[model samples]
Target chain A: MKTLADLKKIREKAQEEMKLRGGNVRIKIVVGMGTSGIAMGAREVMKTFLEEISNRNLTDVLVTQTGEKGLSSMEPVVDLIEDGKPKVTYGNMTSDKVKKVVVEHIVNGRVVSDYVVATGN
Target chain B: MSLKRIDLLICCGSGCVSSGALKIKERFHEVLQEKGLVNEINIIETGCMGPCDYGPVMVIYPEGIFYKKVTPEDVEEIVSDHFIKGRPVARLMLQDEEEKTFSTQKEVPFYQKQVKVALANCGYIDPESIDEYIATGGYEALGTVLTTMSPQDAIEVIKKSGLRGRGGGGFPTYLKWQMVHDNQAEEKYIICNGDEGDPGAFMDRSLLEGDPHRILEGMMISAFAMGATSGFFYIRAEYPLAIKRIKHAIAQAKELGLMGRSIFGSKFSFDAEVRTGAGAFVCGEETALINSIEGQRGNPTPKPPYPAVQGLWGKPTVVNNVETYGNIPTIFLKGADWFASMGTETSKGTKVFALTGDIRNTGLVEVPMGITLREMIFDVGGGMSGGHKFKAVQLGGPSGGCLTTQHLDVPVDYESLKERGAMMGSGGVIVMNDEKCMVNVAKFFMDFCVDESCGKCSPCRIGLKQMLDILTRIDSGYGKEGDIEELQRLGEAISKLSLCGLGQSAPNPVLSTIRFFREEYESHIRDKSCATKVCLDLMHFHIDKNRCIGCSLCAKKCPVSCISGSRDEKYTINQLPCVKCGNCMDVCPVKAVTKVPGMHPEVAAKRLAETKLSHNYDE
Candidate 1:
């Protein structure tokens, strides 16, 4: 804080901490948290994705929650979105399925097509 | 460690805080905790988002959804639906006059044309946190100036930037810095003039409260550029929140060694103290402000030994407005040419305007210089409120003139506004509607000037009083034939002979109204009428018998029992007992009650007939 180097260091650290508030990111994971989705364990699935992302220190990936995807049968749904890549929607997601999706799709840039229910956008 | 998903930036500015923003923030924390999503959703209390008409505003980031007028009760729904469920509340979004809803802050028409140079970090970052400010590139300019640029080099950059004093005078900022720097004083001082006393003006207050560090950074940069060792922030006592935040910013900067001895580990050192003015409008003038800060009476002394040469206990001082300081950091960070490329030929950079009165968006807006009054009022301001037509706009404050509809297209640069009889005095633009009487408007500002006059000089002390008396007479319908001419004469004298800016511009509202709306004053003198019915003495309450349905609503609602007659005969206003409160006019169910301008209906009719249609009733 006393020098230019110190100020730049703090700014860089703060920029990292504030990265979630920024709009541009490499990957976005959307978890359905509507009344029906939450009742079907979507909250646990969202929490799992959050913990996995944080543990990996993936600054480029953002895990968020959404209301409904209009697919009640696939209540615990998760959408993987990356710029220039087609959106991948995984249906009936469980807490155990989050790490595999994060490792393969988020880290390795490969979709877990087994859990994928639909893909578009 | 859970990855945060949403950032709910709730506005905790003074306006929103008064409108229960704190309670809503508390409710958000409670609801997020109840939903066990507290770690995932970050609720940050940010500064003023400008459009205060939609106070208790919250902007959800990542999606950039802006929710306005959010209540404590709405917080739970916002957290559940938007935070967890990710469905933004449509009803809480910003709705325009056409009922068109804008979901994002970027899409709102109020912010469309506004270029935020001074207010860039106002609504975006946390004002209390030095880290948030630094992350947004706050003190980098000060650091850069201290490490690399010499005083002359930094001053040259500012000079090339074309920065002027935003405190209404439009003085060259670099000239003041250079003058202060050139003076061979050991203890030169930099002062931030935060005593914004203009009615409906909170641009300075918002800048101080929202981005205290930016203003501090600005002051420090100027202090560095001018070789100033000490500085003072002369904020008005009316803005307690601004005072607290600025003090907090000073403490944080000192703690981090961004201020005090050898700032940023350089040879230059600077420190600033926050001084609160006693809410005297005259103290906003530079000399008067320096007097108040130096423990003397807030009376202005004569110029020639200006503050740059002899100021703040007889040392070289550079006093700048809050917005002026707010722009200094950006000029260095973004480079001078970038700053100079934005504004007009003479006036450069953006000017922050506190838009109030009949405008739809009653808040702060930072627009580039040379933006037309029509764009400011109609486009950025969202036009006149309550379906009213724009009559005139009172620019500056009590010291500024009124520009009518004819001047709407005039570019609002410093020289352009001065040419149109109004100086950009602190950028307080009070928009008036057609219902507002021009004479009453002038009288309002004149009364303000008369009350705020420091009484040190005769022209300001006695002349403004005489002008106020004339305006009062005109407003109360006792205006005479030669009164307008006398007012113009006194106004010119006051402008030429007054001691400070206060007295010099005291007669502006009166003189400008006389200049533009001369016919309105003539009507008040000759016909004894107020076209807008604002002069209660000239307008009489009349009940149209044809429209009266004998409902007795007006009679019952009349506070003074002025309206008589029962349901059988239909009600009529007893003009003798009527106090002209217009209660009957408001309460009339059948539109029976109306204001008949100038004397009684019969007398007006008789005068009209006797004049043989010689007089023009067309306004």
Candidate 2:
């Protein structure tokens, strides 16, 4: 990936992998690490995302961390950014729920609406 | 990992998150796991999918089944009925008046009507991964240009595309690039302006947060076109997410060898850095943005050299807006003719608008330039929320204009909008319902402008203050007859005599509202009231004797003890003690409370016709 051609080659390989994974299934999991987020068990939720992405061998999934988004009500939250335009924020994410999220959300692409703290842009 | 056949994409836009999308997601997990359908279905969470009002929205793959407003209680029903029985819960889908559901995503009127260009990859790509962006054919245009087209030829392609700045005022993209390119200097710089500062606008933030690679690619293309050594992405500090995404994107681009020295092994070598804004709305303006980027106070200098000749520490710099830069690669990838084909004669390509405020389908919508405001509201926005009649659409934030019902059918091109006293500054169309008072809306924007004013010039500083005072008086029912004329006179002076774009366009909201809804202002001045009942000082709560049951409910709940008379007698409102907070209205179980506004009789009639009053005596 040190050259332009390498960049193109990898992109082509990624496209092939995308086809293997059904072409349109790139997902991002964000764990809130803000003051309220950490106080309300956000660190465990963060660990869950990293563990699950690796365990599942999901090539397209990305796990990131963030601080308090000022919305204190939905603490210990995780935002699932898939496809982009719409971001779904799930609140009070326990370690127990992470497995189910991995199976249904990451694998199945089913939205866990009960925990949806934030919905649109 | 092996993939599942079914995918459930949930909308996680701001509207949906606030609407409890997280709870809905958790409910889906519980139901799916319990039903033993967890392995069979895959759930993916995405960003705002246009119809934010209907969030937490989700679409099931294979069938493209659309669901909206999915509560935790309803998730069980959806999983059972839709996943197990292969029958979608018809109630969850967006339905017409006939109770028929629009099951498919395309069938939903909101998604079908939009033309996604700058947003072509947004809401449909993984923003963090450069691979996903590349797989979607992202950076191919940059690659192709670096290997094939000359810098001069690249500029020519952009010029031919007829692309204009989407930040507002609709400046030509190619001309800016050309100016920087033609300017002889030891060094030149190119930039992506991501400082989105409009009140109700989130288009730029959405673009940056959703698809950062697109913006980076756009900047890279500009760097190649203008022969610049470096570029910067000036994102607002308030948008931490956007800033992070851009930072990630630049790193990824560099790692992939798409950025840094001798890109693609060509002589054209360019790089970019991320510089965050310090929460100033005026930084959206090019000159002010540059100042902010250089660690100076964000202030706009007069533009004669125009940054193209001398900018960014005395170098020719081309600062294309975030949305404007997003269009650069699209024009190069698709032919200029193709990019030019979608929009009107002057305004080419699609424009992304943060469609929100009192509108049903409140989200980011990308539409061709010539689309009508009527279609934006009825078709794209899914009509006004809460059964409120459409009053006006505030375009281009405070610096823009308020377009009324009369301008509904008019094409939303840059020139067309400018002709009607509105400039297509940043495309942020905030829908106003019948309940929204026009004078108050103008005053709100005026207040925003006055607070944000740099105070470098007396015209904007002193002039805007005078206007705000006048509007405040009128709204509070203390307006004199000559206030309207005074506002118009002062508003004109501010627009004319102010320095920079901020001051020059400071009175646009007031000026445009006065132009379209002059009668609303007239009613506020001549009658000493607001017809919309929004101005608290201009209205009084009255006990409707016909509806009052003498339950003493109104008297019991009056925090100010404004109500008089016994339980068996007609309760009268004492004007002296009344704070007008309407606590009596909240506690009255028999529906006795009502309002009497101060406005013209005819204007009151018109307002009543538009507002379907329904008071739920529940706090």
Candidate 3:
């Protein structure tokens, strides 16, 4: 019951995702999924980012997970790696903030300085 | 001219995965694609990178930039700046004790002192992935044994490793293997004792859950050495996660032609199965464990024709605890001398202990044999919680003894611990602070043993109950001068006559406490005083008028309403009405409620001082 076009579409999508790796306007988002981070709601925060990116059709942003290395007092951590700027790590993020990050930071090319862990200050 | 690719390593250890590491991985992919950087970044999930204190952590390679406390919101900036511009995030980096910035994880003090051997693959490899484990040189020893070395050769390698059982008995592992090997039985069995019943212990659970394949590999190697055709993992039903992971690992290994038959096309064929325990504490004993596997009551049986001689279904069997089995593949992989050279001469290799109680870092620790108690408590355990004064440390769970500050210098090995009136009982080290009452602690352990006794032996069943009653009476200010002597006599009798290890070691806590802190017992008996103010009946709560604010908080909160007086004035506790519940003491905002000996403080103090001074003379 399946068509070759569907298979071709799947292959094309995979190829497209593979091809977007080296774009200049790319955005990288890293979420902390360590035990403490997950206990503090990192799962919801991560799902929100994926939903927002897909809904907004933003293809320039990449998301990933990282391990815990101490600082257990604060978890559900997020690190933003923007082009042409210093990386910033944030903590205690929520779903709404993930939306703002996708729209304002990824699409508009502006670092939401308030939520940034390090503004290089 | 060049294409850029960033590798994001995520921790998927239980501690991290439960914190949402998997979702974080998904979010990373979504955000990367949305920002058009999906192709440039490769997200990989790794394992536990110790320093569990700052867990849910990830480190960026190439630059070796370390980040802490990262959330979803911060992910965007990390992507925008670091991966895009290559400028490291300074604020996200870890800070030292002096608040100095540390960019790399190697600079962290918590990691610098640690020498990891048992936990080598804990955080670095994907535990669930077989390829990662194989890439990291897993199962090479099993391959070597099946392909090159004979079963006898494998046994010799184990003997040469000087690997004693890590299950606290200090029994040489290879000897046990050889005993089972020499036994003439057609259906010999090997069992991994995963029923870790010691309180505050999770070393077994973590190893089984984190790296099931390693344990499986070890079991396979052990089976080969002992000529065991089949093995059973006797894990307590309490560890659902460990059971699930191990079952999965076994199934996968079977599918890969490694477990069922003719592994790697060798003449030998072996398989494994899991048997769930009903969570009986006594099942940790080999005899009790074997009995439980037979679908019978888990009661300890007399030894001599031990499990190695006649075991499950009347066949020769070899049994090793979780930590002992975990050390097996490593011994075979690294060779004998490498494993032998790490610890003391008598007890070689590391021992994983669950450091709990008053320690600041309440978690699992694997330290080499012969490490002093002082070093374990201070350097590794991060000292007492809340910086309280260190008083004593109880080793080996209920069957173990408590060591005071005087014994801090004693090296922790099987022989040393036993010589100090304590056995290395499943490696549970519970640190106690100055606030603890040694006598009360002994009573607590005695109570636990009394409840857990299988009642098969009359001496243990009756003697422990009698000792508990005496301890309870002494702690309640009703003990006479002869009670201590009676308890000691009964403890000795029970210890000498008990049938199995469980019954034999039931009185260890009481005996050890009496040997070390006899004055504490004497105070309760001779002076009718609880020095630590733990026994409610032996303490009298009085309000110091100077410190009392007369807020009426104590009077209002008292269940018996024993506290009487006006709010404008000071409060007085009616002695007759006071139930000694300590509710007034807890509710007092100021340090007004003072606990003094019910008899007399000066008399109690004098008696305590006399007893302390005469202790050495008496001994």
Candidate 4:
């Protein structure tokens, strides 16, 4: 039902959103939802993420899913990104960790040092 | 000033998830927020990056830094050091064992030699998002084809590329396109054969799941070239995630007017649908696949009319495997010369392989054609798993043959592999170490072929079953002197008379193994011995009294209770009760139990000498 103009409008709107969201937010959370991760319960991790973010009223974090990186043994991986900092990846995430991540890391001004897989330090 | 955005990629593939990648993500979020830098960076979960051994891997972009063996506990150091202070943590970075220095992913030997083409978009894009796909230039090929190139022109480009099919047959892809193009059919069909049935292969499934739009775009380009109005994706039902992603891609394409009638405002109109296969291995064969699509029994018919001439409801059809279709858009976009420059003289473009078995890096890899098997098996595959001595490698699935250590330097192209008694059958490179028994490897592949034969023709059905029976008998220490000769004769007969590819190439494993390791077969037949100790029947369990700790672990753990002795004394294996199940060998902490050939040592040595003499004679 969409005409050429409508398609163009949609594209323009998408571009606008990209621009607005592009440089504004500093943190990106990448969730591993590849077949292996999904099979190993990545869905529950993602659900807990959405729930925690919504409940805590945090607006700065952006989440997305990606493919497996060939470690089929340890899945349900998550990568955290902050501006001017090297990316930190964490493995074996659970719902409890999701809540802790949101409240302790996103809300407070401290990195939860215990759960880090790799830190720039 | 606003914080600059950073990209973090986490491996979510099946292997890493089982190792707990999800919990790590949650912990990452907590650490990021606690630092009050949640808005400064971005985390993205991605697909398999192919180094499966040290998995739950994470890679950072702009720098392409690779980290291995990530656990939930290491997140904060990653945040504090890498994310906040702009430094990489050396402990987590993959290290070159010999050099003892942290290496970037590209610098690592395992990834340095790999030329990823079909796997190009695997870890880069968000597979589930249509917009992300569009952003990465997904359907741009279809648009270019529709807007500028004619159907004939598209076919010409494919022919110019000299791209042989990746789906085992090694047929020229453009020739197939040209035949379908020239065929006089009002309604033609394009079929994507995604029924990847090989045991160690998963490249096709990963492609569909990670980049479904690429295949869709390739098919759309092909449809435009061949005047085909409808296409079908004949994928197996085993890949549920791949299926779901493909279905989503199709819907998204249609919504963009890239699939339905008058695509991109051009007269070209094409649509696609999915058809699930019932997990039949034989259905991977083209004719058998055609039969399955037609709602008939999944058995192959003799080729002459060929699918291009007459196929899929008696209409002209072009059936291309998933990998071949995956290459189309890239070929068109990059130009034929660009692609043709990478590989050897005859076989142009890179080939994707599922490198598995006794290799340290057991996952998907794509390398340029004409790369030596040695390079692939050792450099890119990370050598044998657990540092085992490399013995042989099985290229091309069950229908393929074993390549010994002598032929390790053979260039992995269609012609070279074929000349070396193997085919590039969908690029399944399963490395085997010294512990693997050649006789057992042959038997294993033969057994698979027999089980999956579809019983359509006698050569494949009866011949394969009979050959397997002989092999089983030989491996079980029951072969007579002439069993090797009989095996060769039977294998040649089956190769000659088989109705389709399944029957025709079913004897390849047996023939190639015999050709390369005839001595091993002779040892099995003449001396009733298994050199690799893999054949249980040909081996006898013996206790090494010197190494025996007099612990009851071996006797207690033995399923057959073949060992009998007092706790203070060395155990003795009752030859009658020993099933050769190897339970005693596996359970013994002191490594007291061992498998010795039942044949006399002199007889075993003479058989080995005869094998060497025969090999030289054949050469």
Candidate 5:
């Protein structure tokens, strides 16, 4: 707080805390939290995504939950959204699959077609 | 978990707080706790989010969904469906004038047209939290000024920014800073004028309450540039919340070493304290404000030594309005050209207006300079409310003039407004509809001036009272020929000869109405009628035979029992006995009773005959 560097440090730290409020983000990870999705372990998948994103210090990435993306058969579904690109829906998501999705689709920009249930603009 | 999955930004600004926003917040907390989602969800109380007409407003982050008029009862549904179930509540979203729904705060038409410069951190951050202000790039301006720029260089940057005083006068800000900087008084001071007493204006109050830290930073920057060692915030006592928040902000800033000696390890140091005024309208004038702060009666002194030359116990000082200081940090943070790029030729950057009256979206708006009144009223303000048509707009409070429909297209800048007979006083824009009587409007502002006049100079004390007398008789149906002319003469004399700003501009409301709405005055004087029926003395209530449908409701409701007729025939009001209280007009179920301007036909005829007989006798 005494010097210029201290302010910059606090700003950087606070900006991370304030990131979710921002409209513009590099990536958004949406997990379906409908009753069916939660019954099928969507909560575990969502937590795993948050853990991975936070562990890697992904400041520009956000993890949010939405109700009923409607494909109950693909319960525990997750959607990877990036600006100017089609939203990629990963079906039958699990704690095991969240890591691969974060690494391939999020960190490396390689869509995992094996788990892809849908691609929408 | 550094970040909550959902953030509920509930507006706790004074406007929203009065509408039960705090209760809504408590209900949300209780519901969230019951639902076991308290940790994942965050509820933060922020400042004014504009659109105060539809408060208490809440904005949910991540999705940026905006909910208006939220009640405590609605909290359970919002927490369960929106928070836990992740589905936004659709019914509570904002609807624009066109009946189009808008969910996100950014997409709302009221917000889209606004450019928040002075209000950058107002609704967005928590005012109590200095870290939130810093997170939004707050005191970095002070840091930069203290570390990199010399005092002269800092003043030059402000001069280049083209930020004129937002307080009303449109005086170039850097000139004041330079004058204070040049004066080598060891105990020079800076004062933030928060004594905003304009009717229908809360722009300064909102800034002080919403972003106290920003104003503090602005004061610090001004102090640094002007070489002032200490400062004072002269806020009116009426704005208790604003005063409390500002005092709290000063304490926090002092705790952080942003205030007091040797700030930021630099040689430059600045500090400030809060002083509350007794809510006198004239104390907003700089000299009067200084006197009030000096514990004297708030009467303005004549200018030879302006506040910049000698102020605050005869030391060189700078007094800037709260909103004027609100713009300073941004000018330093963003370069001068960046600040200058937004506004008109003479007036630069944006203006924060407390838009009120008949406007649909009544709240605080900070729009770029040169935006037309049409855009401000229709686009940003969401047009007129209650199915009323636009009549005229009162700008700059009692000190400012009214602009009519024809002037709607005029660009709203300092020079343009002044050219059209209105000064851009402290930005209080009161929009009037056709239902408003122009003469009455002028009288209302004049009455305010009469009450608030410090009674220092004869022109203000005696002259303004004379003008108000003319206006009073004109509205009271006792007007005569040449009354309008007499008002004009007195108004001109007062504007020219009054001692302080309060007296000099007190005649503006009357003068401007005379300039733009002269016909309303002529009608009031010659016809003894108010077109809007606002002056009850000048209007008569009568039941229309065509629309009455033999309704006896008017008869029952008339306190004077002047209405006669039954359901078999159309109801008629006995005009002679009617007190013109318009009770019959209010109770008419079939659109029967109407207030017609001037006396009743029978009454007029009787008066005419009596006058003619009197004239014959004189002959």
Candidate 6:
């Protein structure tokens, strides 16, 4: 941080971290925690994701929280982002459904199309 | 990893947050994880997107689908239909006034009409995270200036952009920078005028809170260009959020080596600090702000040595407004010509207005400079609220004048507004309706001026009080015949003899209202009545005999029992005993109760005709 070179080095490190965390990353799970979403069982859904990610020793998977997705009534909405691909959204999720998703989608790389709310690229 | 197929930008501005935007983000995470669709789509929380009334707003990028008023129930439909099915939910998309759905933010009338140079990254990037800012090419402007551009070259670019001070006075920013640069003082200073004291104006506060790094970069450029060793952000204590965000941005920039010693490896070094004002409106004036920063009384010194000549402990300094500084990073990123190309020939670049009051869309709007007030009210603001007619739009915050419907078509540039007795001071455009009394509006501003008056000069100090007394007397139905003439006289004197901008522009609201809505003042004076039926003293409550149902409810409900009649007979309000409290009007089932001015049909007819005339002008 003393000189321009130090800033450049930090920037490189930041870019590396972004590369590890961005679209090219293995998997990203974002849960909507808007006020209404949280009121409608979204917090439990988020907890299930944390439990599933760690319990299965799943690596290359990032779990994050976002503000309202502007679709509040469908609270407890989750967006699954595969590496360098489109996002798959699932709504009205439960802990059992989440465990099945971890086994079928995250591990088996199978698209659970029936439970999906939408697909976005 | 730097590239995401889909980027969902959620507006986390104060307005959206109040309407539950935060919970929506958390829901997205929970649902996405359970579905095993994580990390592919990036959800970035951004600042204000201007459409505040339509809160909990979001714009999904790449496709840029905008959604509004989202609730937990609709999240599933949006997730299934738009995300998994690869189809955007039509019902969730933002609907314009015409009921036509807008897929992207650019398609919305409020945003499409605007050319956002200053607010380019606002509501698009995370304000707290410097990496987000850098990803959007933020500090690259500073690096460009420090690495290659000279102080002279940078100043020339700003001068060429035709960017004036956005605070109040439309003074050229580069000229001020040049003045401080030309000075031979060993140390010069750059003071950012963030003490936005204008009532009903929060554009500066929003920008500071939304994109603090932009202002920092702008300040850093000014410091480098002016050869200043130190800089200060003279933000007011009223803006606690803005202060916190800016403080964080400064710390982040300093840590990343974009601020402090040898910025971008150049030999030049400039460091900035925050100085909070005690929330005095007049302290927004440059010299007063400088005095406050120097730990002295925030009284403005006269303009022989202007702040550019001698400022901040008696050194050469350049003072620029927060919005003015917000433009610098963009001017460098996109050349001066690019900046100059958007606005009018004279007033280049975009202007951010905190559009509030009776306007339907009350939020921050940054339109190109030459856009007419008509477009701002109708196209962007979605017209007047509650079906009320547009009467006058008060611009320039407390220091500005009220522009009537006749002036709506005028191009909103510095010269046009000044010519109409309104100066484009700070960007607080309050769209008033027919319900608002002009004289009362003038009084409100004059009262503000009186309270904020530093009492330095006789014209601004004593003269404003005399004018306020006249306005009060006029508004209360005790006005004399020559009261209007006396107010005009005092207004001119104050403008001529006042020491600072506060004194000089103190008479603006009064003078402008008098000029545009003269009939309101005349009715108040000649008829001892308010044209808009606002003043209580001039009203006479009467029940229309034709429409009366003879319920006698008004009589029973009257606090004073002023109305008298049998249940079957048409009720009449006894004018002598009537308190004019408007209870009878409120209680009347058949809408029989009406208030006429001065109990005369002819006067009422005349006022009705005047109202009709103004309504015609509004359309």
* Residue-level lDDT for B259 in candidate 4: 74
Q: Number of the top candidate by TM-score? A: 1
lDDT of 5 at B329: 91
Q: Where is model 3 chain B poorest over a 10-residue stretch in terms of lDDT? A: B1-10
TM-score of chain B only, all predictions? 0.95, 0.92, 0.88, 0.92, 0.96, 0.90
**Preferred candidate (TM-score higher): 2 or 5:** 5
- List chain A TM-scores, every candidate, in order: 0.90, 0.74, 0.75, 0.73, 0.93, 0.76
Model 3 lDDT tens row, B79-188: 76676545567777878558899887667554554555666566555566664555555666677788788999999998888888877677889999999999878889
Candidate 5 clashes between residue pairs 3 or more apart in a chain or in different chains: none
lDDT of 5 at B94: 86
Q: Which stretches of candidate 3 lie over 4 Å from their true place?
A: A1-121, B1-97, B100-105, B579-587, B596-619
Question: Per-residue CA lDDT of candidate 1, range B153-213, in tens?
Answer: 9999999999999999999999999998898988888899999998988899999999999
Report the lDDT of model 6 for residue B569: 73
lDDT of candidate 3 at residue A5, scale 0 to 100: 35
Per-prediction TM-score to the true structure, in the order listed: 0.95, 0.81, 0.76, 0.80, 0.94, 0.80
What CA RMSD would candidate 3 show? 11.3
The predicted structure with the larger TM-score, 1 or 6, is 1
DockQ of each: 0.63, 0.11, 0.03, 0.03, 0.52, 0.08
Fnat of candidates, each listed: 0.70, 0.25, 0.00, 0.00, 0.51, 0.07
| lDDT for each residue of candidate 6 in B92-211, tens digit (9 for 90 to 100) | 777755888887777877776777777877887778888767666677788888888899999999999999999878999989999988998998988889988887888888898889
Give all candidates' CA lDDT scores. Answer: 0.88, 0.80, 0.77, 0.80, 0.88, 0.82
Q: For candidate 1, lDDT tens digit of each residue in A5-112?
A: 899988877776666667348988888888899889998898888898889988777777788778999889988888888889999899888889989888888888
Candidate number achieving the greatest DockQ relative to the actual structure: 1
Q: Estimate, for each residue in B389-458, the C-alpha lDDT of model 4 and write its tens digit.
A: 9998899989898898899889989999999899999988888999899999999999888889999787
Q: Please give the range of 10 consecutive residues that has the lowest summed lDDT in model 6 chain B.
A: B598-607
